[model samples]
Target: METSHPGTGDLATRATEILRELTGRSDAAFRDGQFEAIEALVKDRKRVLVVQRTGWGKSAVYFVAARLIREGFGGGAGPTLIISPLLALMRDQVAAAERAGVHAATINSANATEWDEVLGALRDGNLDVLLISPERLTNPRFSEQVLHPLLTGGVGMIVVDEAHCISDWGHDFRPDYRRIGALLASLSGDLPVLATTATANSRVVDDVAAQLGSDTTVIRGPLSRDSLRLGVAPTSSPGHRIGWLVQHLGDFSGSGIIYCLTVSAAEDTTRALKDAGWDVAAYTGRTDAEDRARLEQALKDNALKALVATSALGMGFDKPDLGFVVHLGAPSSAVAYYQQVGRAGRATDSADVLLLPGTEDAEIWEYFATASMPEEADARAVLAALADSPAPLSVPALEPLVGIKRTKLTLLLKTLQVDGAVDRAGTGFVATGAGWAYDAARYAAVAEAREREAAAMLEYEAGHVCRMRFLAEALDDPTAHDCGRCDVCAGQWWDSSVDAAAESGARKILSGIGVPVEPRGQWPGGMEKVGVALKGKIPAGERVEEGRVIARFTDLGAGQTLRGFLAESAEDAPVPKNIADWCITVLSEWDWVERPTVVVGMPSATRPVTTADLASGLARVGRMVDAGNLQLTRDPGSPEVNSAFRVKNLDGAFRATAETAAAVDGQVVLLVDTEIGSRWAMTVAGRALRLAGARAVLPFALALRG
Candidate 1:
């Protein structure tokens, strides 16, 4: 005998009940368009695109729909597969699923040990939902070993969280998300697919919808967050911005985020805030995974005042009562600004959103905007090298062959892999033997679109128009209207005045410079391939001791002055009195084991005067012997390159002068330079000094560039 199923109306009613249970609110009904999206997925079995504001309950739609489908609402469908962008997002969704009585598991980079168990649960039909990062979809191990079997078994529905990332035109375009289109194509026609994003303009929406299917249903709600009060706090300098944050951060009611554009900026701000007695932590891409988890928890629990962070903290960090979101520098695009600010006022009646635009923001934006684009020459070089290799080539192995930097090379490989031109095999990358064509037109279009978005961001900072409405229009929100709570709409709500004492304190911190210059412990891999005998770790006796620099090339204080002085157009000249004084201050603060008895200068083809003057000034101040400059065996023209290539280029580039070698024997030497780029010059020169009988060498530079 066949069993009868419940009616469509009954299933819809059950979804409401599930929502209430999940939210723990008896009156938790689906928001205006939420039920419609759920119904489309559960009953109609159609692909859906949901463009809603944050805190508008998009996750609820998918979780409830997954439960309804698994309960036989759509022919007793299999488990739902959610493609999440961030690990934090996945954790929150998994917890939400459990509260709704849905068995959920996640396979991500953070939980390698749990992957097998998660896969087993999925294979046994013991899970109602499975979440995985978008990047995991492209991993060969997962694609061939796990994903194939899961797809064969059939997934009831697929959800793409932060769907804007799928579109190249989106502000946060991620190459990994391109795999989602292929995944969608491989699924059955009737498999319900849902893509959700809080930030998407019409262009991104059309792009994502086309990726989903031509007949996909898009349900876009108003982008306005009435609870958010937007404002821009324009400051004359970075110090002023820091002062304002120091003075006003505590006035906010709850924990929040302070977003910075660069990792260094985030670290500097965190340190300054902490020194001022604020409980804060720095969160960036370089933060360890374990630390990231702990910091995320601290922020969620309100243990810290704010997480001074980069974009790494964006996307899917849930804090229901987050009091504010402040940007130390403006994002390059209004779409990104909206997405980050959306993190606030979610589950609260009101929250503050402020922008503190910096002068260097544009420079930083320009660097990042063009860094990830696939250059035709670089792509062709990568492909040619891979084709020549009989076996898979590791990144280190391919670095010298392609002559492209590691970071850019990795991004290029990922783009090619997603385009079916490459594959990852075991420990290395192999060409797929598939014919690939470079999409030059597409990349050019993306570049142009980015330029436009950057311009839009500048306009946003101008604050000439209603801030909320401007963002809404940028996202193509049809209901764009003046959000009366914004500074432009109703006047500024935040105090822009900086405290005098705070400004003085911040100026002191920014001006007092000396960043540690950690020596490279190991030689770059694959140096043997380049005819260099060096490999593995550097010998301790020959290695340069921990050094110091005046500041990073991107620093806010003396860095600005150094950048101006060291510009390509600037003439080589003696060190300025102020910079020389600062150098002396740094040396005085140094806690070296041995005081330098001599100062030796590194040979600089471009800035010889600057280097020689720096050496003489330091020697005079410390009353040490002024050793002559190291002679350059060969002039390696300044070439923009990575570590392996840099090391290869600088081989035999410098030699210790006879006078310097004899004078520095059995004495501590300070190796000084105008600026350090790649640090290969210092490494090579320091080794020469050590080989010449110097007891120890401490590398010093005005600026350090990685």
Candidate 2:
């Protein structure tokens, strides 16, 4: 039952006062639907879902509700709990809470040392708001020790920020977010809950609302941004796109973001832009947390012209005055594209939004879109292995037995843990033997939905209909109407013209190639379990020296050429003369500790001619003795399996020829291959050569797959 508090009639006045204090503006007032949401939570004690556009003051409603409830507006409720998705979002919310005098604290991975302090504050009832990542809900310690007690004791309010992630129908579905449903179920009936997101379509809306409750009050506002001028510019190639950005990034006003499809693309674009005198930086998952914070601050302070980043910088970045957002390639779905572009024109009168569609966008999308779903066979293997284990099996220990990559394995385990089929013990993951059933139907439906979204994205790029209207309809926005500001409606506001000089410079930069191939410093986990007799740091004597590759398979430069050569349908042929020349150039430019006196080829079951030609060409040009191919005692087939299985498969597969061993005795040896997929081949072959008395092995490959 809803509880009535004193001065319920004055909630609007009090909320407005709090809003003014939070905004530091005397005239601050609630926008349309904002006061209604605040009143629903504070006075009516009702659950609410607010699907307002970004910069529409969604945070204001929750912050005001928390303050009112703490001040006995909701009959003396407990402190509010917020399940935020990102550390960045938590930091912003905590700061905003402080400004509003809400006394907020956070528990997340980045601030582990402060967790105790935050917990103390929570116990003391000194915090009005507590923000945490959704992943924390699944942590054994956090759930049993903290969350359970908080739920039992009573929370005044629960907020799921970026609530779209809670639904599989959402564009950015995170597995950890599935735990929110359980958290909601544990709460008392009278407690208020709020779920907020800007990107959810009608399907996602229904899914999230069902998770919230049957009585959830959803308030969805217009999805269109009036200040955004959208446009799509089709590029002929990756180089042309880079050239376009170099030429026209300055044309947009103020600081902005240039989105790339992959981390390699982000780095390449950053380098090319910097070389052409653009002040920019690359942001991706590979960036360290400290560096990420620093770069984010730089962008906020307008210290950089733009941050060329992948999806790592997509959500929860609050830059109200961000002037523009440009996509180097289209995202797989209009929902995702709209969310990214929403960051712009938020607190500005106008911001330019441009999409430079690339020729390889679909290929990149296919690579990432299907990576998260767990295969039935892999899931069953994990369950059977765990069921047979005497104790919890860590991911490494299970890797060899299951034959799944570590990254994919971890994701699968998390899914199972959430499904109640697995539990995390001190040692590792233990099977609960709960008779877990694979939801093949659900997974298949999700996959089909993704394909449909991909097709819709292609249609959006084609621009047959109004871009804004297309996106609005895809989002199931009821107020779908053509915005007169986009390129289609406004007759091409963006110039598709390219600068010749910039194009030439970009082509030259892309052509200049050499990617460092860092040697594997340690054997993958579970190699010992696979009977490989290896664990921990690789012996220095058996390790290959730092090496170089012609380019990454994801590179914008020679990547297309390399991809065609390595295509499954392409016949195995000798290494092309241009690639051979590039290989020679890479060797000449190498700053090695010692010059290689002999070159050895890695035996390839599929591309023996290409591998042999590369080794012989390098040996001839570098004037090094040709050590010939390392004899394959037993073919490992292809290095397409996980690390543990790959190492196991390659064990005792190669032996250095007697002549090759003698030729390389006490001398540096160069190891050449047409391509490096898992790098296991080079590592195993290098170990063989090192054991055969080669002083050192330097690995070189035509291309490195990211």
Candidate 3:
């Protein structure tokens, strides 16, 4: 039988009976000390806070204690309320409670207008527990509609889920958390409080307690994920790091996420992965709502094997069975890293977090600093602009006058709001009495904080110590021990010991007062691929007609080399080595440059080559273009060609399949048959078109009116 320690003897017996009836296995995980803590809280009717990581079953701490309170000291039953940060979690908790034979109702944004039904359940004692979101709690109707009824009738316990949100000092500070304490103060004074979170440090614990406005009792367990093996790789280029990621992805099972620094990077990486034969999807703010929905569904169905996305992918929605979470760039803060990594390994499985650090990440940080830190003059100008406007100036309008980027201005506005200098009005800003006085000290402090975070990235990338230890320390868990599972403890299993030590040394170098030393050989490939392609090589071959040499372009002197045959011109004319030189000379002098691309058969030419053979025969087209091997120029001699080709699906008609629809974008094409008449035609840019119904134009534009 399950051993249960309730506040009173009668309640203890009832809880024991209840546990026996529910799970049939009743070993009391909570013993003498735990029982005493709850009994004292019940006796004094004091608030309690529980701090535990995921998989520790933190929910049990409150529910068990609340059940005991209800049985031992209650006129009938008092409702235990839970304020969850996520609406999905609220629903999940309610379902779990219902399965355990406890009645729980959830009131959140989804059904905010109909929350009275949820309150009706709470007031009539039909529910043992009621769950709501912080947003819902702040609703004007909540106090008038629910709190008054519950407080006057009776209340057993109050729980704050994802309690770390209350920590304004932490990286993931939610502004509404500041109001939670004030809201709690207005609730029934005698109601006991409980807070729970999967991830928490000492600072977060204090924040949670302070936000509750109660004498919070913290119950912590060991912070250990024995299964996860953490690793960090140092790279200088985002592209090279992505190549490394491609090499490692084949080893893991389940889905994965590759985080990019920008929306363009995310899309480019997704495309590269797809071209490399991996099924990939991308999610960014720029993605249309419809595409995001489709991609999200595709991820859940495993139709898309991986997702390359920005930070927007984290919110509580996606719960894929992720095998790994790879950071293509350094996260803005340790809190962001923890939250992103926490998405994996949620269930009884294990997942690894791979960090690829490069100069790009550092450069990105520098860019963020440069972009976000406005000049003192600009800040003053922003204040002046706001002062002049009667109504709050929209964010876009203030950008040109203030000389700061919109995002940075938003950050500044938020900071000013935090400091009581401004208030947000709709999509604009309104100045409070607090003005933007020049404070060098404040500027220094802000800059130093950002620099410290950048230095932490350097430390994480370069440290030879256990990565999990580095992560724990970065997250403010100073007492964290070596997990015996991370790369360092495993003897640099996923990374090079030499590289790791080099990074650590680099960090030390930066720590010194003088100009930081740029350690030679720190970056691979020495420099970015620029001016010339180091691997560029063009093969030489002799042209022949009917097994005899037709023309010899060999020994064409310095700077003039035979790259490839452009055409077999009806048994005449010398092939031009430089198309641009030929075009410039001909088009400028004769007003025409015509170069044909053709192949001669074996009998007709010394060597016969098919188009198929020549397609990849060109050694790196991009490199050739870069090296001026293949040149382009405007041919003024011939008017710019204007023509359109219509792709048909075997019926000699404009109708196309989905595959054909996706392929024909940006190409000049004709639309006919079931669509608009041929007279209303256009040469559209194919890439911008979207598919609707069975067909879409090659280049999308406003429909032609016939």
Candidate 4:
């Protein structure tokens, strides 16, 4: 191959032409640092790091650079390999590529059927850009069959989007992004690389840059967005937050997003808004791909007022004129808050951005913050189990043995895999037999860093300082200054008081009962490995009828009272009069096909008085047979264990005595518990009761947790 690089002026002219094509605007020109990033990759053949605020045309830099490289302006004739983190991002980039007249395709989990066609396009030299997800980098099949040839043979340029995710200090816990560093290191030589992010602080940027390359060119800009008017709406409760939205969402100009910390919150918010005659949909990680596409299109088309969503809606969906962003609860960190709210006011002059902080935010923050980092003891336990196993063990099989929940275990395994302590063989994990020492100091430092971040977030919500400047300085923006548009910099702009009618409606919605308790249809796999003989589907004769919950532990209604009674610090006592009334109401209003003729309490190792009182009260009030406590024949052990382990722990813990069996013989049984965490106890206890001759069993609880 011969070098025939285009002149700087020619490169800029061609890049501008592609930019106009991509933006669909004849006058579209490069924003500050955009063309420089493009030229650094195509002309200087240097690795570039772009740290700009949202909507600064970061995508244009890579797309233009890809076009230039493909046109042979930089002595390259290979397609660009963009390692994007999210599927929504890939969809957006591909669409933008087509508009720029670049033949772009993607290979990701969502497009498995189109992979062969996409690979054919790559092989035939007909593709200009090929986007892949970070997940693919760890796939053994994809690594050997696809990535190996691409990285070794040729690539015009490698683009790492949302590059902050690669940093150990800054992730919503994207363990897969660690694999990108390995991919960057394995490149043959001298390949142009680019990394881009909108919400990285200086520390995160440095961390990502160090992993990217020692010579990486960091082009950072001011983080403040002129179009965003940030504010904090202080509300005492979740109901007040919902009421605020129900009353004031129409005050905004156009469609936008309402961000929630969890899927349940998102769904609840969506239902509240819709019930108040607002056109909104709940979008979460649980949303199906097809529905997400549809809901995204609706919001883009401005057919709906808003999408109540979790973080799954961030990082990828682009709507140029999104009107507003409201947080139903405070985000765990400032970076995440900025990234999500940045989606608004991109192509518009101004957009409203508000945060409604909840008292529970700190608890939620602690949960998500510690979810990714592995503890030394847990790591040792997992490694020992894998090493001692005769064969590779799946997560389900390992869950009971290690005593870590599935979600935490999955994340730990990924971190371990990236640390060279484990490898995937088929559907299970195996020890890599490598010398892997747990870095306790590193984990501790990370925790301290998070604590500082959390403190900063609480400060942001307090609103004593300028909101925009606080966010900008948090990102280490050197040019951070007070924006005259924020609630602090300027005077308050929103109506902070909640409407009486809307507040009442919100209270009604919150107090509404009946969260269904889904019965465990199948016993967890590999239960026999833990000495529990359960396997396959639970027999219909042993399974409990679909159960009911008065409220979730995290709910804001009767749940507040329920959470108080059952809190770890609360003394063991019978349910309060108000909470008991709520429970009895739930039972009386239950829509079951058959009413229970007998009541039995699931024996509680801790809260025996509370559990027994509830069962006896319900039986006495409803005039049903009282069967007393299901005898605790064996200890149930710690409730922190995962499904298979928990089931094994509860296998013989409860015994349905002959007298208890006769009490409910051929009669429906209402099984009561103070709270349900794993639900394995409920399942096993109900099975015993059924085996002892109850015709049907229905489990009821004061609260449910996911």
Prediction-by-prediction clash tally: 0, 0, 8, 0
- Cα RMSD of all models vs. native, in order, equals 9.6, 9.5, 18.3, 9.4
Off by over 4 Å in 2: 1-9, 388-400, 499-501, 504-706
TM-scores of all predicted structures: 0.75, 0.75, 0.57, 0.75
- Candidate 3 per-residue lDDT, tens place, 464-557, comes to 6777676676655646678787767775556332334333433332221111011111111111222122111111111101110111121122
Candidate 4 displacement at residue 610 in angstroms: 24
Flag clash pairs in model 4. Answer: none
Give stretches of model 4 more than 4 Å off. 1-9, 171-173, 516-706
* Model 2 agreement with the true structure over 1-706: per-residue lDDT tens digits: 1334556558788888889888999999889999999888877888899998888999999998998888889685688999988766776788888777799988876555456778888888887898988888888999876787777776889999999999988999988999998778766766899999999998999999999988999998998888889999875687899988898888999999999888778877887898789999888865534456778889999999999998888778899999999999999999999999999999899999999999999887886766688888999999999999998888767877897756678889989988989988864888887878889899999989999999999999889988889988988888988889898898888777888888888876667887666577777654655567888788999999878888877666587688767755568888887777787787787879999999999887778878888788788888999989999898685443446667778878989877988998899999988877667789988999999999999999988765
Tell me which of candidates 3 and 4 scores higher on TM-score.
4
Q: Which ten residues in a row have the lowest lDDT in candidate 1?
A: 1-10
Clashing pairs in 2: none
lDDT of 4: 0.84
lDDT measured at residue 40 in model 3 versus the true structure, 0 to 100 = 43
| lDDT by candidate, in order shown | 0.85, 0.84, 0.51, 0.84
Q: Of the candidates numbered 1 and 2, which has the greater lDDT value?
A: 1
For model 4, the run of ten residues with the poorest summed lDDT: 1-10
Better of 3 and 4 by lDDT: 4
473, model 3: CA deviation in Å?
4.2
Error of 3 at 644 (Å): 40
lDDT, model 1, position 255: 90
